[model samples]
Target: MSEVPLPSLEVDVPPEGLSIGETARATGLSVDTLRYYERAGLLLDPAPRDGGGRRRYGSADLAWIAGLVMLRETGMGIGDVRRMAELSRTAGTEASRLAVLEQHRERVLADLARTRAHLAALDAKISSYRHAVAEKENA
Candidate 1:
């Protein structure tokens, strides 16, 4: 088999940095969510704002926001996210960060296991109903 090269996926960033709305569009988050995150201090310190008071998110800010989005998407609560963000700010908080993430990871793994088990049970029930219906039709 021949190998195929993937197409380029580079993004062009402006020198002045992207506005909050532009960052939201690129990150698939709503403008309100971006503002909420910033207001909650879930991300870094006050983002650079334009003279007119519009937020101008830089590349690093966008990257950090992306990580926060990932954590939220993975079922982490806002409190936990905030704690992790806090831990990340100070010096020598590695152990605390590890502890926080480990606890969340355990919970997520347990939930995943329960979901799989429930799915299997549902599948079995569905299969039984299908068989019963097929038998009735044949009769």
Candidate 2:
């Protein structure tokens, strides 16, 4: 089978960068969420603002926002996300960042184990029901 290409949400970014709305569209985040992230200090310092006070997001900002989105979607808490953002601002904090990611990975692994156990139990019940029905029909 041929692999299908996913539709791109990319927009043409001008030299001046994109407006807050355009960024929200490109990043799949709401305008309010973007504002909240800025206010919550999830973003790096001094995100570019235009002369009219509108937010201008450049490529670097978009990439950082994508990382933030990935961490959040993976069930990272806001506090941890904030910590990761803080850690990113400074140099030589790779170890700290790795620790945070490692902890989250542990949680994800535990959840996966529980989910697999649940799936096994469900499959066993399903097989038993199928066998019972077959036995009844044969008898």
- Per lDDT, the best of the predicted structures is 2
User: Which ranges of candidate 1 are over 4 A from the true structure?
Assistant: 1-11
Indicate the TM-score of model 2. Answer: 0.79
Residue pairs with backbone overlap in model 1: none
The ten-residue window of minimal lDDT in model 2 covers: 1-10
Clash pairs, model 2 backbone: none
lDDT (Cα, tens digit) per residue for candidate 1, span 1-139: 2321222213455878788778888788899998898788898566898889888887667777877887888799999988988987876887897899899999899999999999999999999999999999999
Runs in model 2 deviating more than 4 A are 1-12, 125-139
For residues 99-127, write the lDDT of model 2, one tens digit per residue.
99899989889988999999999999999
Residue 121, model 1: Cα distance from true site in angstroms: 1.4
Each model's lDDT comes to 0.80, 0.84
- RMSD values for the candidates in order, in angstroms, are 6.9, 6.6
What total of clashing residue pairs does each candidate reach?
0, 0
Give TM per candidate: 0.85, 0.79
